[model samples]
Target: MSNLQQQLNFVLEIDRLKAVYRQAMVKSDNNRFENSAEHSWHIALTAQILSPYAEDGVDLQRVTTMLLLHDIVEIDAGDTFAFADQTALDGQPEKELAAADRIFGLLPEQQFIEIKSLWLEFEAAQSIDAQYAKAIDRILPLLQNINNEGGSWVKHGVSKTQVIKRNQYLEKSAPKLWQFVLEQIELSVEKGWLKPE
Candidate 1:
């Protein structure tokens, strides 16, 4: 097949993820359901916009790649929240690996390898770029919850302690961005977007 055809096939494969939307148990300003694809796009854009604020030097391109591909696995595996325990993550790896093998494998050989590597790297959160990408991933949900007036937190009966614990990874991985989240959490609590203890 021609490169265009291969690219087109790969792009079409991602449509499956769009079918896998998660509305955060909250809603956006438009009050629409946010799909996994939409979440990935927001994270990619955030990574590009927030790259400069990274606590350390970063490869923006790598971060963007990680953001875009990280959740393609959600196409098959579904999204699990940060507050969920390890029990939820169980079996997710196998599901996601199967999804990645099929979806990313749609691309041409080199493209498939590139995307798969980025996906795995993001999952590992070992690389500098992966760390920042994970930070963006976590930060966006917190922002959404804050904006939607305790969307997921309220639904899950998540405590402030749980919120802090769930998002604490941000501090070590991306201090500045994590600090911003802390500030927003404080403001959200004060404004009643979050319930006080």
Candidate 2:
């Protein structure tokens, strides 16, 4: 096989990413929460739906691609929550970054660089796309928590205050979505997903 074909073959094998599927806090009606694949697709669709709400100009396509590819590292390194305490989230970038290099490097070099750049951009939240993508990244889990009665938040002992803090940036980038999230938080409490604190 040609070098190009080898890279293509590596990319085509979807089995590499499916070692385990994590439920998104709440079980879906199907008794399964969304997996990383569905999460990726959802964010891409979110970029399309929420582009107009982005506070700054964003390349929705780029944001979507970044969201779709960003979590592949989690396949190897496992996902650490964004609101995880400092130690859980910190001083461990090396492991995940190296994993990103390996998994993304499996693609052609240009794709590796571009995807890596997008992931970095999403992390830095420096660009409009990055910031908007970050909002989606944070917002989706909150939606799951609300829908599933605080699935992860309840499971992980997270407080409503913590959820609000993690969500505050949504107000800056996507006020409309942020408003919806706030309402959802209130409803989750009313629905007994969150015990009032």
Candidate 3:
């Protein structure tokens, strides 16, 4: 196929991401589950809007690109809940890598490598760009849970400690956002939406 054709095919294939639902409920959608596509779009905008708060300087464009591409693998590997136990997470990286290989392979070789690299960078979360991108990624779900009265946290019986432990790296990359998260956790606990322990 021509490169354009391959790119178009890749675009069409990724449309399926919209159908891959996640655990968080959308506050405006009458509590319907958010899809990975919606999450990706939200976090891309989140990264852009929150770029100034990154602890280290980052290329906002690169961070946005990483956020947009990071979850495309969920098209095939499926969304794993952040609070899922270890058993539910076993072999998840392998599954996502395989999904990346196949789904990203649909693009022309140059585009495939470039896009896959962004996804891998986000996964690694080592670069300043990746770190900020990851901080933004975690922010939305926490907001979603808080907006929905601890949407997933309450449903899963999640505790304040668990939420903090899951998301504490935000303190390193985005201290302001981390502080906001801490306050939200306390509010959730006070509202009885999250377990005190």
Candidate 4:
């Protein structure tokens, strides 16, 4: 196949991500759960909108690209809930890596490497761009859960401590967003949506 054809094939294949439902509900959609594709789009846009607040400067374009591609592997490996217990998370890394190899390999060599690298960078969450992208990524679920009256947290019996630990990266990467998350947690607890630990 031509490079253009291969790129198109990869594009068609990733449309599957829209079918992969996530555990978090969408606030504007009558409490229906969101899919990975919607999550990707929202976070990419959020990263752009919130880029000015990143303490460490980042390339907004790179951050948006990272956010968009980060979860494409979930199309194959499946969405892993952030609140899921460790037992449910066993072998997830292996599964996602295999999925990445197969999916990103569909693109032409150069595009494949770039897309795959973006995915890996987001997974590592090490670079300033990746860190900011990750912080934006983490914010969505918390926002959705709060808006839905602790949607997944209540369902999974998640405590404040677990919530804090899960999102601690934001404290250093995006302090303002971290402050907003802290306030949301406090309100969620006050609203009886989360148990204090």
- Candidate 4: where is the Cα deviation over 4 Å? none
Model 1 spans with C-alpha error above 4 angstroms: 23-30, 187-197
Please list the residue runs of candidate 2 whose C-alpha ends up more than 4 Å from where it truly belongs after superposition: 1-3, 23-26, 195-197
> lDDT tens digits, residues 20-120, model 4?
99888887888788999999999999887877778767788898888888998898899988878888899999999999999999999998888888889
lDDT agreement with native, every candidate: 0.79, 0.74, 0.89, 0.87
TM-score (C-alpha, index-matched) for candidate 4: 0.95
Q: Pick the candidate with the highest lDDT.
A: 3
| Candidate 2: residue 92 Cα off by (Å) | 3.5
Per-prediction RMSD in angstroms?
Answer: 2.4, 2.5, 1.1, 1.2
Residue 153 in model 4: lDDT: 90
Q: Model 1 scores what on Cα lDDT?
A: 0.79
For model 1, residues 1-197, the per-residue Cα lDDT tens digits are: 98889999878878887778674743634666678888889889988887777866678988887888888888778887666778987888899899899888888899989889888988887777888888888888888888777787776766666677667657766788788888887787777666666
* Native-to-model Cα distance after best TM-score fit, residue 99 in candidate 1, in Å: 0.9
For all predicted structures, in order, the TM-scores are 0.86, 0.84, 0.96, 0.95
Give residue 189's lDDT in candidate 3 (0 to 100).
Answer: 94
C-alpha lDDT of candidate 4 relative to the true structure: 0.87
lDDT tens readout by residue for model 3, 1-197: 99999999999999999999999888897889999998999999988788778876778999888888899899889999998999999999999999999999999999999999888988998887888888888888888888787788889999999888877768888889898899999989999999999
